[model samples]
Target: MNGIFGYAATAPSPSREEAARVRDVMAARGPDGHGLWSSSDGRCVLAHRRLAILDLSDRALQPMRCRDGRYTIVFNGEIYNYPELRRAAVAAGHVFETTSDTEILLYLFARHGAEMLSHLRGMFAFAIWDDHARSLFLARDPFGIKPLFLADRHGTLRFASQVRALRAGQGIRDERDPAGVIGFMLLGSVPEPFTWYQDISALPAGHCMSVDASGVRQWRYTDLTAILSAAGGRRGDRHAALADARAAIRDSVKAHLLSDVPVGLFLSSGIDSAAVLGIAMEQAKHPIHAITLGFDDFAGTTNDEVPVARRIAEYYGAPHNVRRIDRAEFLEDLRAILTTMDQPSIDGINTWFVAKAARENGLKVALSGIGGDEMLGGYPSFVDVPRWVRRYGRLARLPGLGAGLARLMRTVVPWYIAAHPKAPGLLRHTSTIGGSYLVRRSLRLPDDLADVQDPAVVKAGLARLEIVARMNATLNPMPDTPQAAVSLLELSFYMRNQLLRDADWAGMQHSVEIRTPMIDIDLFTRLAPLIGGLPAGIGKQLLADAPNKVLPDWHRHRPKTGFSIPYAGWMAGIRDLDQRNGKAASSNGLLSRTWSNYVFQQYPAGA
Candidate 1:
């Protein structure tokens, strides 16, 4: 990904150089080319590092200035429908000096301003400076697949793809904001508008912040929940919803495949990735390279959908290969990963392994199945959470028994599946608001944390709970069901922290670009309206019922297993170490011990 860093004031050259250093630090993202530009009046400076993807011509090197010299932009994303947008722009008699989408984006903004965001469909987070208007325009995508950091320290405003990029600047981050760090540990990553250091903020998804000397104002341009509520249940019924969903998926995959570079597939035994492969194969002229990942020596059942992946690949006569991560290498890579993690997360390692394979296979870009579940009610949480929610009414009226029953649940369930059957994994995953599933789902609930751990840690959690509660209150004004809220929670939390970060860094570690066809902006707008009123007994039922133009039944049944990790089976690793001494390490809950020991602690038949 590329970055934008600058100072709009007539400041010291060294100050601008410091901003340039922040942009330069992301060089691993851009090895082929780089450039920096300063406005003739010296009031603005823009710097960019590049990875040559499309039209790898020198003309595409950016910090691109508009023909009228009224604007400059530094963007980090692909305009998947660039060719189509180009046709429209050209028809309007707009001239172009380069074939890159970066140019089209600048020109589109010149023509449409913020309105340009709705017409373009791809993952993006960008910053634009209109010198004539003396304003800075910044935005992130509806799905937030790409990241942008915004920090306002004193009077200067700084932005970049990663916070580290912003941190590289000398004068930025004047305050050591521990509140963000507290939020990070409590929430697994800091929430939007809060960063590890206090002064930095993330520009939240679907929102834009426009700043100039007059001051700054932030506004949200999209709200999927409201859109879904307004769309209602009629269009989302099983038959009609499926049709719109199918059309959206195919169109998005087609647009995502519009790169000048050799694109490949990160095929897994899941419907999402399989759907991507299936759709791309129809339009692709040559055999596409497909990749599958596995653990060769581990004793646990390998979540190898390699068999399923091969079934689909062989059926299509597509060329494919398998890559393995033996136990030893997984350990070795895990250590390097921790230091390189940029953000501490349980994901990204899976992406690291596969993206490395794709890079070696000579593909510069790959497609993923992200956003498929959120759009289609594919998660069990969408179903199971509501079940527990029904039971929650009974718990509330019971008064004193509520705490007792929740605690009783903690003791009976096995560590492996303690919350299983009672609560869906989704509700248990994040600390999102008002889901009854939280009773069955939490790793360790607030009371449990208060009872067993450090009081200081518990107090810290309570403080962040206050923050999340306020956020929940803010979102309450928008309308939708528990399902829609759960979907949004996943998007805000897991998708950003786990999936997208894993995909981007792992791919970039090899300079490979991983694209998600299912997450196109227009496609999301179309599908968001169809998600609310789903029928029971069917998962991703909407997508399943659609008349798929290209995918076979083999791919059609590919469950969303996602990059499966062997979470069970006794292994001699830090997992065991973490179990024994990892209590202090857990920001969430304490891991449970073996059954015999727990039973020993209780032991009387009627005790």
Candidate 2:
């Protein structure tokens, strides 16, 4: 993993000192080396912080220039298919400098421009300067395994790999975005295209943007719905589809394993991680390393993941380490974890600890089974949302049915069930898949934000941030089946906003790279047609069956339990924080809503 930062200006040119300052903010992402480059006219600057995963040589240092000096690129993330891409480039009469993927990427873009993104098969966020056209091209990998943030200030477009880095060096006053504040409260993480800051924006996943004298333009290079749509009801035999899905998974894991350093697996009790370990062992040339995180609260209970994870690791002959985390250790690292947070999120607590453990073991990269649920029919959302729609379709469409019931439920329901803020508002989302998803995943209903924040702010934020509309926008080019629709929603919203982004910041907090092989666009494209109408009850069945029966019956057939922490109990111990009172208020009842707000206050925009 690395960090990229740069600015392209039309009138107000950037300076070398400013670029250096931006690069310095993310020095931890690339402790091995750093570089700064500027155009001859000083209108553009590119900076790179290199983690040195691919080629550990000075020749691989960037901001790398093309052989003819027509283009310069500052890149972040790994290009797993660089060897094949390099060979293709060479066959097309391209010359090479270093064996680094960064150079291959620059060369590929030099020849193919933005179209080169289609050929890429790894996680990346990069900016390429076309000196001849005085234009800059920026692209983020389809799944957003990497992050990119941009800001417009004084006629210059500044961008960075992280929001904090962009804020630290953009040289502008940051204002809190009311919509982003509400988005976080409603969804537990800020939605795409909006950051907590008013001026700065996160580049959406699966899209590219360009800045030139003509102005800025953005377009999607790929999207999950579009890819799934291409399936065109082409599902074949069930057995054959299962075989193809397994093959795709195997290929993806092998591809992600391409690295100069040791790659480890974040093994868990779930079938997703177990499947990944089993597949990696079959394809890998050497022994795989595995790490599992367990909590003291669930040491001997079914909730403990260490025992099962340890069994799978031993089955695969991987060197395993069960990182037992206790309440005292969590408290000790709570301050640092809060500080490492790039944005306020209630999730990522477990990720933060696991990444810390991985780094302590001297590993730089680890594979995670994050998108397995999204790709396969692994989440309860797959069934619950559709069922809600079926059961309450007509009533949900009544103008005031949801709002009226929400009020009644809040007044009468007990704290345990009522603490789930969205339960009463279920009817509001049942009319459409997008609306249903918002209610399904929401921490608090959008209409309830007024209870926590100012009425004016909540009103204005709700107007600006249309949660239902945003969800529907991802569904415009719809998938063929209800199951595919749920998968698309999960991948676009939950996996992108929470899981992938969390993995980036938390893993980088310890300088450990977290790779998700199941989330690759290529792999998704292959499995989409086969899994389109997959039954929600058969959670990850294709994956569980794909590993040549490596998974034991319990690992594959056990009840689905998520990797979780006792956040409510732990946060209660922190004296500085307001303890959760058993009330159905929007602000203090739920641990997620309270923690999200606390993190925001802990690290305010530009803090």
Candidate 3:
């Protein structure tokens, strides 16, 4: 993982010294060394902060010059398939020096042009300067797992890994983007293509843009939004979908485990985590290394899941390493976590810490079960939406007290299902604007957000949610079913915003990389449609369907417990101390809360 910064002028004239300043400010990202490259007349400048992962040799350090010397590249991320691409290129008569993916990426474009994107199957964000065409091609991975930012102003085009680096560039400052801020506070992370500052924007995932003397143009090469934003399919076909899910996911797991360095697993005793462990154990010739992630607050409660993790390890006979985390450890790491956040988010703190542990365990790569819910109806919302649709149907046809009470209940109750835990689980399905938004990401409802709404935010959230609903209506054609469409919208809008961003920054902060097998194109494309097709069941039942022997009985039946930290408890503990000492504690220590109150002003408790 590395930080990349560069600027292209709308008109020529940013100096080398000014470029040097941008490099200096992002030094923490690449403490090992830095490099600056520019065209002969200085129409552009590319700066790289290196965090040596692959070669550990100067040859691997980037802002790399091309084989024919016509192109230069500044890149971050690993191309897991580089060795194979290198072999094919070498067989086709190319030469190489350092065994680095960065160099391979340049030549891959040199040989394949735009088609190279289709060939790439790893996380990445890279800037390729084609001297021959006098153009710069900037591309992010299909998943948007790596981040790239662009700020265009006064005829200048600027880009970087973090917004701070962009802010440090000469002749640049931006007004805050209101919608992006509110999106962060309510959703816990800002959705892509928008940043906290209005003038700056993210290069959407699965997209590539090129800029030169003529100007800039962008094209999307792949899409997750289209798949997840659909309605139900035929229910009876699930048996085949389950079969497809099994083969496709197992193949991705095999591909993801293909790393040059030691690979480990993050096991949390959840069905998703245990499922990955089962496949990993089957593939391992020797004991596989696993990290059981947990916190000290659960030390006294039965919430400590380390024992279950140990049982999985015992079953697999793998080497299990238990690493306990505490509030002090969390507080100590809070500042860096803030810095690691490219945008404020409530989640990812736990992801960052786990990656740190994975790195400390002498591993460079790890596998996580990230997409099980989207594929198999794993979330409670997916299971209940079908039931609520039935209840709502009955009420619409009735002409009595029950009908009036049902309408009254829905209006006063945040949702119809709060009457029982199962109801919250059911009606809170991701089918409509409010319910979909809440199901996927919101820590607070629109009603919950009502307490902290500034006039601007109310408008923006409503507009965004309206756009999402309309998009779902247009995209999802399945009749009599809204679950699949809701799942897709949630995955596209919220997952990309919160989950993937957290994985990228948090992992990079610890100089480690995380790979997800379930989201692999070949896998998800086959399984996602079958989710809402089945009568109410677990969101990711396809994952658990692998075999009864593979998972714990409790895990198979457990409620969907997010990979979460007890943030409310953590916050209250600090609050008590502040009251006693007559000082205040920052909710900023928690990304979600920080974004909610400071950025969006929408925490349920209010500032």
- The top-ranked prediction according to TM-score is 2
Candidate 3: C-alpha lDDT: 0.66
Q: 1-607, model 1: which lDDT tens digit per residue?
A: 2333234353333355765788776776677787777665555567777778888999888788888888888888788889989998899898889888898889888888988887777778877889887777888887677777776655567677776667777555445344443444333444555665566777877888788766678888877556655665446355665677778877887788877777888888777776667667776766678988866533244366778778877765678888877667666675555544544444466788888898889888888777777666676767665565564555543555654555555666546333342332223322344433343323334444444435775676457545446445534544366766666656655566557866766676577878887666677667765655555424354443332445575556554565764432222344424444233223223222221222212222121
Give candidate 2 misplaced runs (Cα > 4 Å).
Answer: 1-10, 408-420, 580-589
Please give the TM-score that candidate 1 achieves against the real structure.
Answer: 0.84
Candidate 2 — worst ten consecutive residues by lDDT sum? 1-10
lDDT of 1 at 379: 69
Give the better candidate number (2 or 3) by lDDT. 2
lDDT scores for all predictions?
A: 0.64, 0.81, 0.66
Once fitted onto the true fold, the runs of candidate 3 whose alpha carbons sit more than 4 angstroms away are 1-10, 15-33, 225-241, 282-287, 300-302, 385-441, 445-450, 460-481, 526-541, 544-549, 552-559, 573-595, 598-607
RMSD of 1: 6.9
Clashing pairs in 2: none
In candidate 3, where is summed lDDT lowest over 10 consecutive residues? 598-607
Instruction: Sort the candidates on lDDT, descending order.
Output: 2, 3, 1
Q: How many steric overlaps are in each model, in order?
A: 1, 0, 14
